[model samples]
Target: MKFYKRTETRKINIGGVIIGGGAPVAIQSMTNTNSRDWKATVRQIKQLEETGCEIVRISLPDMGSACNLGKIKKNIKIPLVADVHFDYRIALEAIKQGADKLRINPGNIGSKDKISILAKEAKKAHIPIRIGVNAGSLKKVHNFSDNFLRAKVLSSAAMEHVKILEKHSFQDIVVSLKASNIDITVKAYKIFASKRNYPLHLGITEAGSIFSGTIKSAAGLGIILYDGIGDTIRISLTANPVEEVKTAYSLLQSMELRNSGIEIVSCPTCSRCEVDLIKIVAEVEKKTSAIKNLKRLPKPVKVALMGCIINGPGEAKDADFGIAGGKNTGILFKNGRLIGNVNVDKWVEKIISMIKDYCR
Candidate 1:
């Protein structure tokens, strides 16, 4: 059932987290809070940590913000990456403040000398640098009509930045080529991966609000990851960063690349459905979202919530645990066998109780 065969790339250490070189694809998210607000930033990061975010990035808009990187890093459990743009001094300050990594946009981070300075400092600090290239910010492309050509330009821009770092004997680097358009993003990553061995951080930049963003990121990241071309991912959404982390986990789990959390297989209610299947599934999700470390279970937990006997029985049999809904009652299946009947009202509680025991 597993469809992923990870692309092999050199490993880079950000804090203690290892990325690429066949490591499990790491999930990352950036904070939207003011970087100077250490308490708020730390609080958001802690929430992300609880939801399984392995790496967190914070934007450094000013010198004051860059100075607070260490304070924020001290309070969080995950790797901290300082996102810098336009100014190399901010990146230098971020390195001095003990940032685990630095993410710089190639288009605006300035001259080769500035890049060398950042490279030397980063190498001395032993921190990796992520060259984040975005299609909308490309300095080389003005008006390109072809997606493939745009992809080439994006890939070339990334390589040019990489060379600046590599020329200074800095090799601990990660790269991201992002475009709001899925096709351009995928093409850009493929071209870059084919030419180098640096670890890639995947994402769809400026992907709209939650509903649209999730679908776009899932489709784009899915294609790239399926081709075994990415090492890490950030589901950029115009929603809470927590949703981004959750979406990243869902995408990875659906591909069989990760085994964590509850995987719900619920049916789209049909005319035959006699129970409120939608409400039941929503209740189950709400209750189980608080379950910590479900990955510690022996295997991924599959919970099915089917509305009728037609596809219910089959899906329930295939899942680790499930409920096939009926008029006022439901059929419970656990470990591929009928456990017994339970009233529809108790389905959510039953599933939660079973998961707790299974996880234990």
Candidate 2:
């Protein structure tokens, strides 16, 4: 069944890319490197761009790092965003130095006048602004019952920033309401989405390491995106940023919203198993890593490598191509029809050649 996205009204441009108005959901990631270190920061941005990150954000903690925005912009292909906190001056400097986007909470950036000045500079630069409100930093007036209070605070804070940007006639904007709690994060986004037309950036803030973070991000992002609520997404993890990109694409794939390169469907080896499915899947993943630019399969292809025929061919009948195990031999199938029998040792090489031929 085709999922219908609830397209938000506002269409904001981040550099040359548009967010909202039914655009393809953009994938975003932030650099963990210190922005003052140009070399490290540039290298990370390049790597993120290579990983299919449509937008990259850098933390601009002070004026010096904010000034480095121009240099960072010169080196990266994707639009660069400045993540600023409390200082409107840094936000202004970042715009002057070519930041394509600014992530700031106007309420925390000193005063309404200062926010206006920064907004004016951002408007003059033709850059979009993202009002990122996190649960950990809610304002004092927000004291609803803790049960639903986080969502209320996040939504209230985001709207307040949105108002400041709108007041200055700065309509190029996006909004993110992130919380470490999955339920709160989901609830906050639903509330904001119900009330605003600005593009929503989806994420579960401070989600733990690779394993835990992927689960949290997937659970929260999955529910929201499935409901047609997100315009852009980031799988925020404490691990390497590359993993974040991979997780984002995986989440998109699960929702049938986007696809990148190969989607391998494999089964866990059980007592009925005969081959090393895990090792083979990993090798296949590495070999096809170069095909990341193909956002969706040209033709739908499901390549399954299963441990045994007990549940193999039937389980993978939808696969365009697949393999099921025997003792030391395996059966290869294409579109659920048996193709040939091959030794288990040659499975990886044979699968790679078959994929190459299919792509051709």
Candidate 3:
């Protein structure tokens, strides 16, 4: 039921997780914990992994943090990506410590000879390198007056780095072209994909707080992904990294591109609404958050929670299961048929029970 044709690209494995080459778009998040504190980093990574994060990146600011890569990798189930900058030596150290992939900006990672050295070492380890180019970090294109021109400049910068790695006979690469602005980010990715078949990682860099960041990322990423351009994605929110993973899966699910976890289709209330819809929806979400590995379900268990009967019956019938509220009672339905009514107080408990049964 995939609606869009994916752009074929070279497949690259991050540890055992694959991206591109018609593989499912991988979800990634970065740990905000200090890498040198290997214990804390491991704890955060484990949390992300349990929340369905397939790959995790951690900052390697110095040799101290680079030395902890093995410790972090050993404790986590997902692939570990090392974020290194300025020094090529840190990149080499990260490789030595068994980083599944390396993220670097060649523009600031020293000279061509140093990059060649790092490239050779990474080749030896059979690990991929991500050339992450952020608009804020780009040395060129200070004026972003015209988004198309900015996108061209951004794509050029990423190509320059790609060529450097290619020159060294290193082709295991992933590329990310990111900007805070949706227009520039979408345009750059479209431009880059048309030029190379390398796997592209998508994101809106420095996207703000959870509320706004989710909207901005969805709007921007939706455009690029719907066009069938990106291979992997991260919704970079200023909030906890776990939220980032949740947001990523939700976005993919909305497009019917992925099926994992609970897909709640609820309505915004109005005067016609008789029940406390806001409170009910919040309670449902909070309770369901404890349901781990819903991804194991054959598909997302579609759940609809509506505040009024006007459109409630239709929406409830449309979902795998749902509750259409009226007064203090709700009409529960499953697979388009009535399942009898339940008190408002029992909605959360009933939905949780039905979901577990549905999954089983």
> Against the true structure, what is every candidate's RMSD?
1.1, 1.7, 1.2
Per-residue alpha-carbon lDDT of model 3 for 1-360, expressed as tens digits?
779888999999999999999998999999999999999999999999888999999999999999999998988899999999898889899999999999998557778788788789999999999999888877676776899999998999899889999999999999999999999999999999999999999999999999999999999999999999888999999999999999999999998877767899898888988889899889988888888768888778999998887788785676898898899999988888887998999998899999888878
TM-score of each: 0.98, 0.95, 0.97
Error of 2 at 239 (Å): 0.8
- Give the per-residue lDDT of model 2 (tens digit) for 60-79: 98999998889989988998
Candidate ordering by lDDT (highest first)? 1, 3, 2
Clashes of 3: 0
Clashing pairs in 2: none
Model 2 scores a TM of: 0.95
lDDT of 1 by residue, 1-360 (tens): 666577789998989999999898999999999989999999999999999999999999999999999899889899999999999999999999999999999889999899999999999999999999998888565578889999999999999989999999999999999999999999999999999999999999999899999999999999999999888899999999999999998999988877776889999998999999999999998888888768666568899999987779786677888899889898998877888998998999999999898788
| C-alpha lDDT (0 to 100) for residue 216 of candidate 3 | 96
**Cα deviation in Å at residue 15, candidate 2?**
0.8
Q: Which parts of model 3 have CA positions greater than 4 angstroms off? A: none
**Each prediction's whole-model lDDT (CA):** 0.91, 0.85, 0.91
Query: Lowest-lDDT window of 10 residues in candidate 3?
Result: 136-145
Cα lDDT for residue 311, model 3?
A: 84
